[model samples]
Target: MTLSNPADGRDDPYLWLEEIDGERAVAWVDAQNTRTDGFLVDESYQRDFDAVLKILDADDRIPFVGKSGDYLYNFWKDAEHPRGLWRRTTLESYRKDKPDWDVLLDIDALNKAEGISWAFAGAARSPDKTRALVSLSFNGTDAIEVREFDIATKSFVTDGFVIPKAKTQVSWVDDNTLLVGSAQTPDDSTEAGYTRTVKRWTRGTPLTAAETVFEVEKQDVAAWFGVNRRPGHEGLMFWRALDFTRSQIFVERKHGPHAGQRLQLELPEEISVGAEASDLLISPKQDWTVGDLTIPAGGLAVIDLASFLSGARDFDIVFKPTPERALQSWAETRHGIVLELLDNVRGRLSLLRRSEAGWRETPLPGLPDNATISAQNFGGEDDPKLGEDVLFTITGFTRPTTTALWNGRSAPEKLKSAPRNFDPEGIEVQQRHAVAEDGTKIPYFLIGKNLSMATAPRPTILYGYGGFEVSLTPSYMAIAGKLWLEHGHAYAIANIRGGGEFGPSWHLASRKNTKHVAHDDFAAVARDLANSGVTTATKLACHGGSNGGLLVGNMLTRYPNLFGAIWCSVPLLDMARYTKLLAGQSWIAEYGDPEIPDEWAYLQKFSPYHLAKAGQNYPPILITTNRTDDRVHPGHARKMVARLQELGCPAWFNETVAGGHSGAVDNSKQAQSQALGYAFLRRTIAK
Candidate 1:
């Protein structure tokens, strides 16, 4: 299975597959796809695809929306509109079951008119909400073109602001001015292919004439500029210097003694900032010493912007985390702030407001226990000067998502509810903790038919994404419910370390040199499941994607006998050369720099590509990726599968021609991919 380049004298073989779009590389991809389809695209797989597609393309799915002036805008995709449509409805109308929506832009129509495959990226509206800068991507790639559209006229503004295709960021400063983050020249990008400079572009001027207002080191991940248009805080510009978890925040003074000066906020690099009226809210990822006081990591603090600018070191603590609790997220509303807290991986919603005495907390209602609840500033959270309306969503393994709107004074009104795609009758969800190798109690959610301990073990799929501080919360899985659970299968979601389930410390516990802690934690969950008789090793499967892909890949190589099947999607397998591929360089803060000899020594131990050896029995694996994924290179999946095949191991690789890192452009495509994946798992673990 070893490959090497004799001409270059390098041991690593199959690097040619990294060519991506090269004719030879594409030919190789086609051959692999044909081979995989021969086995996976069977009659059962097609039936699953049809059933999943019906659920995905159903019109009953909830269309999430955000407030913009008098409208609640939403982007919708279904069987009829594959490319989707950016439409809006008045708040009053949106409150009704069948809202009268106004179609602002049709992506399919635009693609047809332009004779190109254009996916709607996003849109940023002007301060007055009369115009917007719409971003359109080709085949869902990161690179996009932004064009100005007049909201009132419902047409593209002729001779208006437009930026050509590139990985660009656009924020409207005013009706005629925009703050743009993009390449000034063809080479003006970071090693990770992100914009390193931001410019202020005005109407009726060429992009070259745009003034450079902010710039960062080319080695940094990216730089972005945004203007806070929250009432009294209008015209306040905030600039961020981003480099993975480390970042610097700067604010442009619009008033006071330092008017027109860009002042760097005195805060730790590992802190995230947000504006709450006239105050600056900070969430620190590391312990910060301010004057004589020490703010623990994962603590939320706030200081008046005026006082902070005037050399005040005193900060009011909004919320502090305990050993098992951490701040999940926070949003500012007109009357106060809403904090989403996770206590031992369970959700708790709280409201904070500035009182004459100090900051006060009030528990918000309407969320169920043992479920995941997420909240956002609904009507006034966007403006910070208007209303106190907030929108929140609640879901769990057995419960379908229910979105509601709350105004802090009344009971939250249900705005929409996702139709039951799968029957949950007799289904049960249990939260259990598995002791990790390091003695850390890892929390996981197990879902299946209600059964007693005397019942026999059932087929199961254990899922995990144990990196990037991403929390694995409870959510209804429609496809799993219909395709797997309905057929008497169980599902488990592992909330392992290197996740924000507990707090920053939980994530830091498994990052960098200790990255293997996450893999060990995942394996611990699998072992617990098997030992408890919920599922046995022979009937169990493992699934993950992106960083999670790396998780299951480790299981495939390091613990091949632990599971019957492995479903790795859009994975990073070639750790040795990951930094040199696509945006891999940006994640050195989390995964450690592979180029460093000391770091590579530890990384190589868990690197699936390097760890996979010949003459060793491995579990059935299905590795999937998208050809147009500009983030994680598809070559990682391609090379891993090819190497496994060379080792005489049974492996399947599916690379879609379109779609980005997500690997699906439309509902149909998404359903087909899921159908293929679930089918593989079923066939591999069949009794």
Candidate 2:
């Protein structure tokens, strides 16, 4: 029942906050409430802001692994702390300091700050935590750059195989070899995308001696990699494809030059991976490993670890209630899975143990149903059970994320909540679905209050991201929900088909030549809004980042009259030129192989760059791009803005000097972004 201001941390009675890491916890808080108008939640906390917050208080010596910032992905001593050290920490300092620690990776000389130096992925060490294999990114001709940094010494040792594309996460089978996957960079001119490659890397000299053990054909290359899974079952290898349908499990030999080369098995037939947490986990030195494996059919499949290595094994299916049609976050323990389930439209934590007696499902003793749980990635020195305990954050649909701790042994401890200036009861959000031109159903969430621009048109903001099988679910948005919902009460989110809403099938149905289906779906939604009495072209606004930006670009070209303003953030707008840009070649699977005539024909039909015309009635667009966006280059936003300006269109361009994809680095900056976005929308539509 305590309220506080975010700026001074002063106890204010105006705002209610549920402290997740501290004793004080507020029930309902929303970012949209920060504005004058906003969204709402049920008093029962049954359906509301569905964000996550976790709290733990076992040890004061260390910080809980905080959420990653763009520039400082590893510098989160905490994001919720009113005063935390993570804010001052930079990527350079983190890369410089960690080497002094015990068994830190030595990577100064070879792993340049200017050059690529990402942390290795899927390096499962022995039970003793002694030796580990490293896989990092290096830039080459066809491929940009990536290098492996030893976790123990923080040092770089060797070069990697030349992939015509970029690679992600290196999965280690032993101390010496790694499962390396490569993605082709895009062809900037013709919009050609390179096919992705998957192979193995052994301790050896670069290119001269590096070896490849597995290579998929060009025919089936959508170029996306999945989370590496190492089950307790011997020889059983599981990976969840990033751009595909199901989680494929393979069995290979444990030792040999050809080890892990052949795929002897695939499992969970008829099971397509769905919109779930990044729960593909590998146990360290355990005989049995549990993966929070999701099937498109809904729920989790706790498959038996012995099924891959042994002849017959028992597999269990845990369909934790997902009443909100939202995603679930779970952590694996030798004991079982600590599932942070979503119920009542908020987040809750429960422990499901895999014991000799079968499975044990228990909720955290004292934490209320309104509490939400977040899984900390980096290790902290709290109770071993503290690590096992799922962190829960509780807030109404109008709540900001807070932290809390729930070790299996004890009840729950509260932590700090979001700034008090924010309020949820001030706004209201409604989830609505609209049908597309192809009879495709598109789901969108609309948040607003006193919700109309009767005298004038109210500013309406819309956001969407529909690619890579990633679904944009309706959650407690710190800024979008607050700024747009509260201040303007005119914001909407369209869950288009390119996302993993229905399943992998939903994603694939909108890929390649059919990619226009996604754009069509978005436009259909926009058209519905204009026709539905929500708003019209002169007051309607659109926003999307990454792939969704591409969608926005198409909407501008195809149905230019449907919207008045556009906010394209770090978008992939130049489809014809995308495959030619840095790392652009890796996306052939999603956008289609532009090099081929057939694919080109299809892509040209909807590629935003090809569609941008001099006489086109383009919407007023504010294009935001990043200079150091290692993943999606800022060139996209830049080129599109330049094109619009050249065509005499009103284009406002903002190039983030630093930070990768997101222009902002910290929560404060992000909040400022919210203010700016809301202000922009208000200026354009809300009068």
Q: State the lDDT of candidate 2 residue by residue for 1-687, as single tens digits.
A: 211112121332321221211222111112212221221113211111122111111112122233222222222312443112212233234334131222243233223554633322223332223333333322111223344444344444345222232434344455555555545333111122333345556666443244544444343323333322233222324343332332344445444233455453344432433211212222111112235433334455554333434433333555433324433455665335766554423345566776678677776555443334455422221223323434455543355555565454665545445443335554666667789887766777666665433423456777777787666554455545544555555677787877765444566678887888888888777877777767788888888887878888877888788888887777887565566555565577788656676677777676665567888778777666555466575556655655676789876665443445554333333433344444555556665
lDDT of 2: 0.50
Candidate 2 weakest ten by summed lDDT: 49-58
List lDDT for all candidates, in order. 0.85, 0.50
Candidate 1 stretches greater than 4 Å from native: 1-9, 184-187, 235-242, 381-386
lDDT tens string, model 1, 1-687?
222212121566888888899898899899988988888898999999999989888888888899977888999998889989999999889878889999999998988889999888989878778999999888988889999999888889999999998989888877888888886464568877888888888889999888988878878888876686665665455545566888888887565565677788888988878865677888899899999978889999888887897899899888989998889899887658889998777888998998899999888865787788999877563464746788889987778889998887889988999889888877878888899977888889888887544567889999999898899887878889999888778999999999988888888988889999999999999999999889899899999999999999999999988998999999998888888888888888888777677787778877898889998889999999998898999989998998999999989999997888875667777987899998888778855
TM-score of 1: 0.97
- Top candidate when judged by TM-score against the true structure: 1
Regions of model 2 farther than 4 Å from truth: 1-74, 77-249, 252-263, 268-303, 308-331, 334-387, 393-397, 408-412, 421-425, 438-441, 450-457, 481-486, 527-534, 664-683
* Cα TM-score per model: 0.97, 0.63
Model 2 Cα RMSD, 1 decimal:
14.9
List clash counts for every candidate, in order. 0, 88
